[model samples]
Target: MPKVFGFAGYSGVGKTTLIEQLIPRLIHSGVRVSVIKHAHHDFDIDRPGKDSYRHREAGAHEVLITANRRWVLMHELNGEPEPSLEAQIQRLSPCDLVIVEGFKRSDIPKIEIWREANGKPMLYPEDKNIVAVACDVEIDCDGLPWLPLNNPDRIAQFILNTFVHD
Candidate 1:
């Protein structure tokens, strides 16, 4: 399995945007990256009119949709308990790293994304898994390293350095 790192933050703090910026940088650095994002609400990648959607709505437990360039696999829990992070990791093809978004309380090493304007309390105070803070403004990280949120290159390098040592 790939090494796992995570991004944890409250809603609308740019967790998704930071991950978007970081993925390409990591890929450029030659680290194969996969992402597992936890959604707190019901969500779907397929629509009602699509064939894959029809298959799923008809009681299929899994449906894989493919085109020439890419493919995606959608699985229905169908009342099964949600799997743990490790179980989800096992489903991904081997890569150098897996950048998980959400699962804020998971034990994996994570960078807590923060924005001062968001008016949210810092998570590092409670989440020991948070290894660093990525924020729009400098703040006390309680001795954990403070990372500049705007510099994807620096953040990407930190991730690389941390990954190698771990």
Candidate 2:
């Protein structure tokens, strides 16, 4: 199975920024990485008036937009049901790592990004899945590994060393 890690935190806590930084580092280390981001809103990947959007509105279950070097398969579900993280991972095919940006309540392990200025709570002290914290605060981590908040490369290396290597 491909290795999995999550970047989770309260809204506006810089979780996305941290993930953005980590991706390049992981790639440079020769790990093929995929990401599954959870959203709380009704998101749309196909824009209106576009051919892909029209095809989906015409009852297409899946639409593939292909180019010379890229392809995107957009699947339309009939209802709003959250797929299991494992199921999502399966959809990504073979990869060295899958870094998820949500599913905080799920069983998957995570790196909690906490910004002290954001006034958000620490996910580590309560969630056992939170294996490490990337934070700007100096609060006691209760012995959990703490990576500097602004250093994405270091956090990525830490993840590779701890989880991906051995």
Candidate 3:
């Protein structure tokens, strides 16, 4: 099975930024990576007036747009409960690793991204699945792995060393 890792943090703590930086490094290193990001608010990938958008607006349960280079499958819940993380992961194509952002309550191993200026309490103390922390300032983590938030290359290397194996 492909290895799975996650990043969890309160809003504006640079979780997305870290992931953005890590992707290129991982790709450059020849590691195939996939990401699953959870959005709390409603988001739309298809814009209004587009065929796919019209199809979905017309009550299509799912709409798939295909092209030579890429394809996207949009599933409409229509009040259905969101699928579990495991179910979502099963939908992805094979890859070297799956990096999940958010889904903090899930049991998968995660690295918590923290920023003191975010004015939010740390999540690692409460979430046992968190295996490491990337932060802007030094923290008293009781020996948990600490990664510098400013250095994406180091962070990428750490992730590769910890999760990816030849």
Deviation from truth (RMSD, Å), model 2: 1.2
RMSD of each: 1.1, 1.2, 1.2
Model 1 misplacement above 4 A: none
Which of 1 and 2 is the better model by lDDT?
A: 1
Per-prediction TM-score, please?
0.96, 0.95, 0.95
What is the Cα-based lDDT of residue 52 in candidate 2?
A: 94
**Count of steric clashes across candidates, in order:** 0, 0, 0
Q: Over the stretch 1-166, how does candidate 3's per-residue lDDT look in tens digits?
A: 6889999998888889889999999999999999999998888888999999999999999998899999999999999999999999999999999999989888998999999889889988888888889999978787799988999999999889989973
Model 1 per-residue lDDT tens digits across residues 65-141: 88999999999999999999999999999899999999999999999999999998999999888999999998888
Residue 135 deviation, candidate 2, in Å? Answer: 0.5
Model 1 score (lDDT): 0.91
Q: Which regions in candidate 2 have their CA more than 4 angstroms from the true location? A: none
Q: Which residue runs of candidate 3 sit more than 4 Å off their true CA positions?
A: none
